[model samples]
Target: MIRPRRPERKAPPLLPPLKLYKAILRTHVHKLPIELRSLGDEYVKAEFKAHQNIDNPLHIVGFLTQWQDYLKNLDGGSWQEGKLSQEDLDKMSPEQVNQLYELMLETKRLGSEG
Candidate 1:
């Protein structure tokens, strides 16, 4: 009996984690509001550190894609928040929820300052 040939898999492109991390932090410094810049920097640092050892190509691509989109939005001054659904909130850890709250407060504070 003849066996069917398996499809060839293409490898995902390699992304330099440290370089991307620095680039994103720099973008945040320039694009984020004064009150948010530090918080955003910390968040990115923690996140990058957490994912520094990721070996899954698909996961790496997804992560890079999301951050790239975020950087683009920041560059364009189009960063905005949308309402999180109940399910979305349920999926977040308490710390994540608190961070969101802090982000909201930062935005309000910046608005008042300006």
Candidate 2:
């Protein structure tokens, strides 16, 4: 007898748009410098508004994942002109410190050229 194929798994339901919107803005934009904060808020609002009618689970997940990563980079200061604070450096292991140093050098090199 031939074995039956397993059904494909479905993605979990997405958080409601307003809920996700509030969370992202609260977590990602509230603390930014005034001018930049407003700009970021507007961009996020526009993007979310544009995607409001998206019904595909895959696309919604991808959009949420992309914004979550953006929030993480903003919170971690990884994209804050690629600069790490002395306090943050002091908390890292020697290996991490070395990695951060290398990353900073690479960012600085690219920053100068671009």
CA lDDT of 61 in candidate 2? Answer: 87
Error of 1 at 66 (Å): 0.7
lDDT of 2 by residue, 26-81 (tens): 86555565545655677689889888899998988878876766666677766566
TM-score of each: 0.61, 0.51
- Name the TM-score of candidate 1: 0.61
lDDT of 1 by residue, 1-114 (tens): 999989989654444777777888888878887777887888888888888899998978877876776666777877755366899799888987998898788778877877
lDDT at position 33, candidate 2: 54
Off by over 4 Å in 1: 1-15, 81-114
Q: Which pairs clash in the backbone of model 2? A: none
Candidate 2 lDDT trough over 10 residues, lowest sum:
30-39
Best by lDDT: 1
